[model samples]
Structure formats: structure tokens, C-alpha cells
Target: MQRSYSPSVRRRRLSAQLRRYREQRKLTAAKAGAALGWPQQKISKIESGEQKRLPAAELDKLLDLYEVSGEVEREALHECARLAKERGWWSKYKSAFPGGLPDFEAEASAIRTYEAQVVPGLLQTPDYAAEVFRAYRLLPEGEIAKLVEARMARQGILNKVDPPDFVAVIDEAALLRKVGSAEVMRTQLRHLKHMASRHNVDLHVLPFAAGAHAATSGSFTLMEFPDPLDASLAYVDTPTSTLYLEEEEEVREFASMMSRTQSDALSPIRSLSLIDKIIESSIEE
Candidate 1:
């Protein structure tokens, strides 16, 4: 493929492949480490993607130990390892979220998001984003501006020629909530409608009538890559920390929540109608 896939994703996929091969070979981490003359922690980190980069020599050794077959498979792994070392545009924003959301988002084939209290970062307008940053009052003025800029940059994925299918299930509470002044919200809502017009953007609204639900209490994102070798990821952001769930069992739980949330949300047409109603209201306008 001509596309420049995110290096981080390749690294992750590579790590997963190695882990699978080790298990298939019936080799414990301890046995693998003993054979490779390395510490078990080293193999553990490599398999878990905690290692920043997988050196070529180490990868060769692991493949040989696993008795990996065929030149094509070997070359593919090497290629993935090579791509894994490169950085995406978001590399410069490491200060905001080091090796975080952007790394995964850069090459995602599908992005499923659910928001409760505010607009998803991908859809927030600049002024609206700034107001959101100011809400916490944790960062300095300069930091707020930087974060807004970083957030705006993140939205660029929606504009890509082969952009991920962006699906957002937003609670009605978020639409009614006042983040910034009327003008800022008006612009934000209008932007949402505009984005919804696009082919790849799928927007839905979960109404208050849906009653209390488990998923709506917080927010999360589920990202899926094009390659089946790459497992789905679940992202959760909190006041103090962020979590990236890579394990299939854990990601499945979030995936189930997203499925339930989608079922309760208003359909695309009805979602637009609700948005229009909100826009027509005195507060948002």
C-alpha cells in the first residue's frame, strides 16, 4: 500500500504477532528469555509495546526462535518494524499527550466515540475548545491555547482523502449544556451539522428520555484499524489520567457499551432534528 500507516500502529501489530507466535510455539517468556540470553522483562516489554523500538537483531532472534516460516512473512515483519520507528505529524505535540491518542488515530480505519458532558474533541470548534480548556483552569493561558491548537490539528483526520469512518454518539445533555457563549455554541452546532453532511461522518444523539444508562455517565472512544492483525483499542480520559485499553477482553467491554449507546441514540435524521431544535432554542443560539 502507498499509504503511510502510523508507525506506532505497526509497532503494536508487530508486537502482537510476536506474542502470538511465542504462544503458538509453546514457549514461556522465561524459556524464551533464557534461550535468547535476555531478561524475561525485556521480552515482556516488547510483547506489551512498552518498548519504544524493537531492534532488528532482537526481532530476528525472536523470529528464528519461533521458527517463523517463509521469506514473505519475515519481510513483512521487518517492514512493520521499520515503519514503527517513524513518527507522525502529532509527534511535536508530545507535551500534550506523549505517544497517545494521535498515534492511534493517525491510521485508524474507524473511530467510534461517545460523549456525555461536552462535544467530542474531534468535532469541537476552536472557540468552543478554548472554552472547554478554560473550564478546568488547570493549565496556564498559553497551555490552553496550545491545547486548542493541538485539538484542532487532531480533527484533520476527518478531512483525509481516505478518512476513518467517524461515528459519534452524543448525549442530549451535552447539546443542552452551555460551554461557551451563545455564539460559540451556535458555531459549534453548525459545524456538527456541516460535518454530518460528509459521507464518512456518522452522527447520532442519545436523548434524555433514554433514561439513565451505564455508558453515558462517562466518555470513551473505540478505534479500529484496517488490518485485522491490529486489535481494536479503547480510550478513556479522566481528570488525572488517560487509559488505552489494548486487550481484546477489555476492549470488548467498551465495544459492548458503545453498541448499547448506539442503539439508544436517535437516528441520523432525528439527531439532526434534535440538533436543530437545540440550535433554535434561546440558550444555544
Candidate 2:
């Protein structure tokens, strides 16, 4: 079966391609908009992926304006435009995850995550995830259940035939913090060890002894794509809002931070050993 591309990823890929083409032609957004007889705002929106439903005729015109004549390149970009207009599986829970990070995550070639407070969402068990939502948000039971279900569904990506390379560095404090109960935490810790064993997933733990290191502020996920034109995206999920950064410099800084944090963390072998110790402790408690 052919793989389906997420609209979020498609949009971003198309946006970056369009912007690069214009830049190569030595045209600013305003100049490009003027040449195409379009408003500057439309150019900005299209380049930002905010205008998801870009007409093919307009895309063709933009290509013509940018002198993109090669058939192969044109067809690839045409496919991107087509995919951007289509919704992905996560669109069903659009309200709960309005930021579209999940869709980007679904299509990533690699995912680098750093967490200082809690277990990464992709590694969370259902019970542990439920407790996280319950403690952090004041939503009704029905809403919480829906969110939890959506979160679990996100994990399906890990089981794909070609799963992304997953690397996560977690704080020891997150391991010790009790989410639901001792039983819940015990299960969660065991699950972490199991996930760490996966060939594609690399798990590390930052011990408290390695204090005041990189990424001490909070957690963020850095997503990479197979297509170089797609660039990299850094996702920071805060209590109030979710922020996605696409700037080259900002994304580079996050990538650097991941390297630093990983250096400060325990290796996979030792991390699993620490997790086993935590599981035993949780069981005794």
C-alpha cells in the first residue's frame, strides 16, 4: 500500500519549497505577489502554509513565475500541493490538538525529544496518560477520555513498517514523579524499558547529579523529514499554548541542545537499569 502524507507535513514542505524558489529568483514576497497580481498577504500565507487550499492553477502560475520548468520538480511540487489539501488521520481530533504537531509527527523521519517534567507522550501508557491529562487539565471525563484515546493512537506510528528513529532524553525527576498511583507508575516504568528495547527507539535518562544542564527550562520535540526542502521543526508544548518553530537558527539551537542533553544523560543500557530500579521502588512503595 502506498503511504499517505499528512497535510501538516505536506503544507510545510510546499511552503518551504515555494519560499526557496522565490528566493532563488531574487524576489521578495511583495515582489512575487506584485508580479503574480496577488496580495502580499496571500504570498505570506502560502509561504507559511496557512493557506492550505492553494489552487493548482495558482500553484502552476507560481511555478511558472519562479521558472520551475523541469517536469520532475514540477510534478513533485504538484503532489505536495495536492497532499496539502487533504486531511490526515489526526484531523478527527482537531479540537483537542489544534496545533497540528501530531500530524507532523506522523510523517517525521526522525524524532528527538527532551523532557524535564514528564514522560514523553509517545512513551506514555494509557493509564499514565490519563492521569497526566486529569492532573494538568480541568476537562470533563468525556473530554479527558477522548484526549487519552487520541494520545494512544499517536503511538501507532512507532509500529509502522518504517518507523522514525526515536531518541528521547528524560529527566530522572519524571521517573520518580508519581502520576496516578504506585501501580500505574510501576507499569509506566516497565513500559519505558520495553519501548527502549525497540530497535528504532533510543531512551536515555538525565540523572539529578547532572544538574543545571542544557534544556533545563522545559521539554521540546525536534522533528526531521526525509525531504531536505521540508527543513526542521521544533515543537514546544506549554500549558497555555503550543509553539512550533521553523526558523533555521532556532531549530539548529534546539538540535544542539538535544546533543548536549544526550551527552549528560545515561546511556540506553544504564537508563533501562535505572528504570528497573525505579519499577522495583514503585512496587515496594
Candidate 3:
């Protein structure tokens, strides 16, 4: 069960709907504000989801201006507003995800990830995750443990009754590169096999034979929501900062890359077979 709703995502949903409604009425933000006697920035912020709180009265006013008459429609938007103000389980370990990946991930109906060097975090084991973080070399032992804990907690979404459909397109190099000890790698491989078998998860491996690829630069995650009002999100993490791209043009590029990579990667069944081969021949005692 999803104990909490992702405020950021909900806000995004609300904002996108509000913007669409305003556009449908051909009302500019400034005009909408002028008619409602509101500050221009207030309307802009509400539509952008930059504001933290939206009073019920103000929402009603916007709906009225937008001619949103249906009770069901109004109620749904109101629910989105209410959920937009709520928090999720990752509040405490905020530092681990400066990118707000968990926020979007919690409510995502589907998640597609492409990795050029490492396993997707959602599919990584505790030991494997710790080893990867340790390679950062700056964090203290305690900090490393905290990150690992948070990473594991994030996996809870996968176990929920109605989990997000997850698709992972991983590079062959990532599978071959040992993260921890040989035993750790073995455990991690088995875990991957187990997870890939799940009904909602689709795992593929991009073999070296594929040669050049679309996501050659790095890895990225794209999250899709069930609501049509909420646009898909494209997340890219860099060494210096994180990017949350919501524009369709930018998101389309990432989606295209993922699609192309998936085409080149082995099928799910063959991918699993390849995993077995890796474990048998490369992973040594």
C-alpha cells in the first residue's frame, strides 16, 4: 500500500490541469488574476506548482473562472490539491535523493530506466548498493549506512500490492563489473533474476556487441503517471546536480533513447540466460 502521496507529483498534476483549463478558456495568467483580483504571480505560481498551499476558496475561484462545472471533475482536482500538500516516507533521508526521485517514483504508474555502468537502484541489493556508494569515497561509514537504508526503504514500492511497472535496460558491462565480493555479486545476480521474474518488471541487457548506443552519455529514468493531466517526468542525475525535465520535447528524447536501447538489448528470457552465463563463467569461487 502507498502510505503517502507524492506532493511534488500531485502538485504537478494540479498545475498541469489548471494550466490546460486556463488555456482552453484562452485566458492568460495575467488576465485570470486581473479578473479574480489576484496578484499575477499568484496565478502563475499556482499554475506552475511553485506554491506550497492552495486555499480551497482560491481553487474554487479558478474552477469557476475556467468553467469547470462537473462535480466529479472539481472533486478530483480538489483531491489532487489536497494530496499536493502531503508528504512521503522519504522526508527524513532527503539528502540521499537531492533529485526527488522517490517523490516521482512513489506515484509513478510506470518507470523506465537505462543504465550504462551500474544496476538500477530499485533493483540493487543492500551490499551491492553499499559498495557503489563507498566508491564515492567521501561519505563517512555512518552516512554510507544511512544511504543504504534509504535505498532499501525505497524498494518498498516494488513490494506494494499495486506496484509500478518497472523496466530496466542495463549495459552488459555493469553486470560483469563486480561491485562487492564474488559472493556479493552472486547474491546480487540471483536477486536480479528473482526481481526480473516479477510480472511488473522487465529487465534487458545491452550486450557489448550492440556497440554504439543512444544513452552512451549516461543513465536516466522516466516515470509515467496514470493521470492524463500529469505529464511524464524525465530524471537525469549528474555529478554536480540533478535535472527534472517535464517538457514533452525533452522527455521524448529520453523515451526515444530508452526505446532504442531496449531494441538492441537481449529479450527478457535471453537476458536471464545471459545472467546465468555470467554467473557461471565470470563469477568465480
By TM-score: ranked, best first: 2, 3, 1
Q: Go through the candidates in order and give the clash count of each.
A: 0, 0, 0
- Give a tens-digit lDDT track for model 3, residues 3-87: 6589998888889899999999999999999999999999999988789789788999999999999999999989888888877
lDDT string, candidate 1, 196-255, tens digits:
999999999999999977595589999999899988999999877888888889999999
Name the regions of candidate 2 deviating beyond 4 angstroms: none
Which residues of candidate 3, in runs, are more than 4 Å off?
Answer: 283-285
lDDT of each: 0.90, 0.90, 0.91
Query: Which candidate order results from sorting by lDDT in descending order?
Result: 3, 2, 1
Q: What does the lDDT read for residue 32 in candidate 1?
A: 99
On lDDT, the stronger of 1 and 3 is 3
List of clashing residue pairs for candidate 1: none
Model 3 error, position 104 (Å)? 1.2
Candidate 2 structure quality by residue, lDDT tens digits, 145-170: 99988998788888888999999999
